[model samples]
Target: MKRREFFKKGTTAAVAAGVIPLVTASCVGAKDMVYDRKQDKWFDLGTGKTGSNSRKKTVAYDVAVIGGGAAGICAAVAAARNGSKTVLIQDRPVLGGNASSEMRVHLNGVNNIKGKAERETGIIEEILLHNRFENEQESFPVWDHVLYDFVVREPNLTLMLNTQAIEAVMDGDKIKSALCWQATTEILFTINAPVYIDCSGDGLLAATSGAEYRTGREGKAEFNEKFAPDEPDGWQMGATLLMSSKDMGKPMKYSPPSYAIKYTHEGGHKRRKFAGFHEGIWWIEVGSDDDIIADFEENRHKLMGYLHGVWDYIKNSGKFPEAENLALDWVGSLPGRRESRRFIGDYIVSEKDMTEHKHFDDAVAFGGWSLDEHNPGGIENISEPPSYFHYHFEEVYQFPFRSLYSKNVSNLMFAGRNVSQTHIALSSSRIMGTCALMGQAVGTAAAICNKKNVLPREVGQKYIKNLQEQMLRDDAFIPKRPANDPNDLARKASLIFGSTTSSGDAKKLINGFSRDIDGKNNHWQSDGLSADLQLEWESSISLSYVELKCDTNLQRNIMMRKDSRNDELYFNGIPNELLKSLSLEARVNGKWIKLGVIEENRTRLIKFKFDTIKTTAVRIKMTETYGAENVKLFEVRCYA
Candidate 1:
């Protein structure tokens, strides 16, 4: 019998006998079938190939973070470090969604905003500083391990790689557990948690949990955005398959595959650009006019053909002599998506909120990138430019806590490209650096919720100050606002200086400005190498933790780059102005007692913890800096 007829007969016979057989090409020869008791079904996934015996597993945590990209990484680390048991679930073998080795897109943030260098701080800055300390070469694969190290090193975080969150176990409006399928181990994971964060760029977990969301471009009349189209349409930014090339120092041969596309100068020369060979090409994109989520596989296949076609043209076309020795080094298999389903929140961010700088009382995060909109035609249109610049912001815009949580679902919250915003607003807020800040905000809020035993909405309404105070204590910056913790014991005490400051007053340390920005002069700088700043009170008080905000040079860049190096920013060693050695002390019974000392400090925020004691005075002693002669600090606080 013919192949088609034989498979059809086999399928019919299996259905009649109440036994479903693997007849399709995807399930042709799989003999291993495991029955899931919880799901009450059978799965024929190819997990035996990885050589693992377990087929099912269960776990619990205080918080669960889905999608191990920039937002998810920050969320998991922030939640874990803030004293919450957190679990991170990732679908890919490695971390970093778009900036990973699998998809080598540059992690852009407010750096590209106008011409000023405004880098994001907090957990994102910590990750970049780690990369600068370890991966100096800026290798993509090495960057993957750098992200891995950041997640695994956290003591309270549990990372589960190669696990895709397939289903959401919901109880009424809350997510009871996240059911994930581990492809390599062939095991199903049911992770239960009180709070859930959906940092997945595509909003996969939100969609499965019945969270209301919006997709496609909004009409001009909807949000009154000038850049929006006249009518609404199901069009989104295209997915890109970034490709990189390297010179072999010798000639390399090339041949086109059967599935590769055929292109000429008339088809792609005028529209597409191929100037840099070392970095991945971002123009070879697809899937703007089609459904990005429902038709993901088809879109990815089409992008692969287009990518190979571009490479073929560069090598075989013989148009440029620079391509003689250059060969394709890496081509991404996974397409880095730009836009998809966005959860609907209480407030939908509009273009006016970004351009006019609207005030949000519960602002947790901010963004400053330009409104960059890509053409819907994608690669199919060669008549227009690949992108259209809509508008730029005079200053950074604030993101509200109302826009970060679900309006319908009680326990759901999201970050990254899928936040609550219109299409025009998303064009600016979609950058990875801005997304990282949102992750930090939501994660900090999640920790507060777990501690107080309240939902996300309650945190926004009643305990907003608690969330803001925690973020500032952890070194996160809130635009136009200063950290003033009323519960802090240092706020009620008097501050004294051991020595005079040169540039600014020593009283600036208690003014609550942690970062130095334009028109803001609140930092205290000492005159000489070693100086002391002491906090004294009339009566003795019990203290356990001391938080210090130092200067790490926020005006310069510290991230790893692929192109030419900027020695001023991306140096081989640590920043020159960072404090390297410091010590904390307290005076009890007329004698100074050393509490803690740090010989090597690499971060902007430093915390000293010791046994609780009643002391009348606390002192911070500094000895040496990385390079600067004078010691500079932003804020100092004591908590009991």
Candidate 2:
């Protein structure tokens, strides 16, 4: 009756009977096992194959990612980087499902601190940096290639493009394998893994494998979410087919397709064009509120017609003087869907969690974008406005790890827009940046689970805490602050340097360093530091070590003097002669502190220290001899 023995016997029996086995009594215990006589298998199965009749293939992986979007990519990279044998199965020919180059939708996420640079970390960050370097500006196709290159180059990652995961194989409550179809070869291959992640934005794997999920919005009372509708509504946000056009100098004749005119103005105004309008910003019209997968064909035809009509209108009308030279540039091959099946995980993140800024015990990621929900119906229904709710918190709110794994299905974890969150909550966290962070968390968690041989739900907060710390070290920001207090101070100092309310003393010091000098700080004045100035001085002095000193601890104040011409330097501390024989470097606390030298002026501070004067003088002489020309000395006052 031991679990291992039972699993062995059960698997053997199922294989002999040609039946697909679901859960093994050994894994879940007899009381938890429910046999399905009709299917000739155990209930609560994750793998698609049933009874002995199903095809079987041998494959093994440390971690398996079921989608190739932002989440899947991050998850796979994190696992691989962490030394896990990771495999990524993507249904599409190219990566970047919604934000792909073929789809041509810009990745949208609010930069940290409003004006700070975008958060780029892990594999996704590398790709973004490469793209920036290659294009100098944003180019969708180039960005896509960079993403592709990142995955392909990773040594521990196995990327199976154009492969669809049709079924998940489960041993008791854990996923053992997934059956995927290779589009090119039409061969079904099995991928076995100790851990699996569901990044398919549609929750395809969770649904097919019997993972518990929800398809529509929840009632307001369930989670006490203020944004939820009074009653459960089946309606979900619509999808859009993005379009683009180029200037052609003269309008070209075009014919409208039959379904292009589906919308007639209720007030008797002429119908508006829907496609071939402008560049990147133009989005064509199509069906909404209807079944997206089922009606996709009809919608495509209507969109084509709309494009033709738009071109016709441009040729015949004189409204667009600037667009007279426009021509059809490109159109999206697939529509970008915003909402789909939301899997029910161990925890459901609600709007209240976001609005109230609720902090979770197992926080993994943070999101700051506003709650922006597009209506279930497409653009035609302009009678009602789109839902827009902003979080009151100036900082990003933390998301818990529980929301990433399914409550009913023990093994599966999900990320991206399909994470276990209500529609309103998803509106804010669904952005690519947040999703990338979630992906990193999931990948790291999966690796931990695989190494520890524990379920993701059972991994506990300590593991998640470790993962968050690692993420911060890797440059991905989470809700929590970093451990290094000095880093915090340095960041604060950087911000203060550029602020308008900077003190007169601070401004004088900044200016004296020469507003735009190179390392020497001797070139043109007021030009500001050149772009090549090394903010990160790997081979130079450590800026953090530099500090100001005063003779008296109680009255420790230094005045920075500025001349009428706005060019001067002054330092106050112990007089220079007192410490004349001490060899002291201009380094503050072992960090380099540079003072721009004025050749003809007496603009240097005196120094004094309690230690032997010889050692201090030696340090100073060494610094003055080898330091860059811009380096200067200031009075070092001994405080008692």
Question: What do the candidate models score in CA lDDT, each in turn?
Answer: 0.80, 0.56
Tens-place lDDT digits, model 1, residues 9-124 = 43232222222222111233433354322433434476534343556678999999988999999999989998999999999999999889888777777764445566788899
* Alpha-carbon deviation at 131 in model 1, angstroms: 1.6
TM-score of each: 0.89, 0.65
Model 1, residue 126: displacement in angstroms? Answer: 1.1
- After superposition, the stretches of candidate 1 with alpha carbons farther than 4 Å from their true spots are 1-34, 37-54, 112-114, 265-272, 498-500, 567-573
| Best-fitting candidate, scored by lDDT | 1
Model 2: how far is 16 from its true place, Å?
25
Worst 10 contiguous positions by lDDT, candidate 1: 17-26
lDDT of 2 at 203: 61
